[model samples]
Target: MAGTLTVWKFDSPTGADTAITTLEDLQKQELITVLDAAVVSWPADKKKPKTHQLNNVTGAGALGGTFWGLLFGILFFIPLIGAAVGAAVGALTGAMTDVGIDNDFIAQVKDKVTPGTSALFVLTTDATIDRVHEEFRGQSAELISTNLSHEQESQLREVFAD
Candidate 1:
């Protein structure tokens, strides 16, 4: 099945958290199917960001770790050493590329989502954008990136731009 991966940035961690909850509600209502979701929150006092994934299945957990690890590595420009780390990175990169999410997008998200802020990364199927926008009306959030067509991305930007 085709899926869209999107990153929504918020000025405050609380806004991101609320948006995640809204996404959960949409999933429950069958408006969207959330395959995977993660939140990156950077607290003011913390030196590093905290990432939390929606699903905690063992297999999914390891994949999620690779995803976040690569992200953090890119974000901080950490050089990967050892064959195991290199191999894992290579594998994850290929997997993400196949899914239409490239390293560039991840880097962009890492750059934009800063300390005291948060971002929600969602992989979803059958999303009702209009209804989701309505649910988020009057809320503050930025559509950072998505594996969506130009027109669709524009529509989403306009929806949240207000």
Candidate 2:
């Protein structure tokens, strides 16, 4: 059997709304289970009463900023190796901010999500990755990253099957 893995990366929580709706529709057509939902939200608010249950999994700004820094450095320096070390160091400094965990930026972000910067990852593995991709052809969401192929998905499904 073959399977597919599609990562629907979104800038906001609602970005996956369409995908979720599509999943619901797909569920109507066939049996499907959500393998995982990655959400970046405020840690304290995530556990509060009356809060949405799914937003518990959170991402942090400082970490994301750091990631952006590192990515920017590598991407920028790729074509300009003459500036690699300088760019990398610059990226690291630009990531720091006042009033957060010092030297533990990632930990701080994990403990307290920064404002206005986060991501949600919806990982769906089904025998029908193509259909899912078709369902998400054009939308406002950005494809931040992805991993998987037909053969790999099949192997993964078997390894993680019910």
Candidate 3:
């Protein structure tokens, strides 16, 4: 089956952290197959968010470490790379574009996930969308997933720069 990359935004700093448990439980029920996952938790007092890769949960299908690093780097570290990384930033941007993660999506993620907020990025396949969606109901979670098509995700693995 084709895979999907999904991002969920939460109002509270620990909301995404809490949701991880739910996701794991859902996976156990066979409602979804989680390939990999990560969380960005930005506490109220912190200047930036903390990005954590859920290494333990990832199975044989883990997307390499560099993929996650580059993604979070683009999302949170571009400012630091603005002048320093120079042309490399252009290359990274180009690579991300190849995967359908365009500037608009990046800007939207930046706009919504801020300090005192959190986000969960999950790579999965065979998801029961409505059932998974219902699990988070009555919560402040917003599905801010780039919602990349399976084709886009396939392109991502092929084109992502090391």
Return the lDDT, model 3, position 87.
Answer: 88
- Better lDDT candidate (1, 2): 1
lDDT of each: 0.66, 0.40, 0.83
Point to the candidate with the largest lDDT: 3
TM-score of candidate 1 on Cα atoms, chains taken together: 0.70
Error of 1 at 162 (Å): 40
- Lowest lDDT block of 10, candidate 2: 49-58
lDDT (0-100) at residue 124 of candidate 2? 45
* Candidate 2 structure quality by residue, lDDT tens digits, 47-155: 3211121322212211233333333233223335566477655544343222111334333333332333343344344536566557667754444434445545444
The TM-score measured for candidate 3 stands at 0.90
Ordering by TM-score: 3, 1, 2
- 1 or 3, greater by TM-score: 3
Deviation from native of the Cα of residue 108 in model 1, angstroms:
2.1
Model 3 per-residue lDDT at 128: 99
lDDT per residue for candidate 1 within 103-135, as digits (tens), equals: 787678867888888877776668898997787
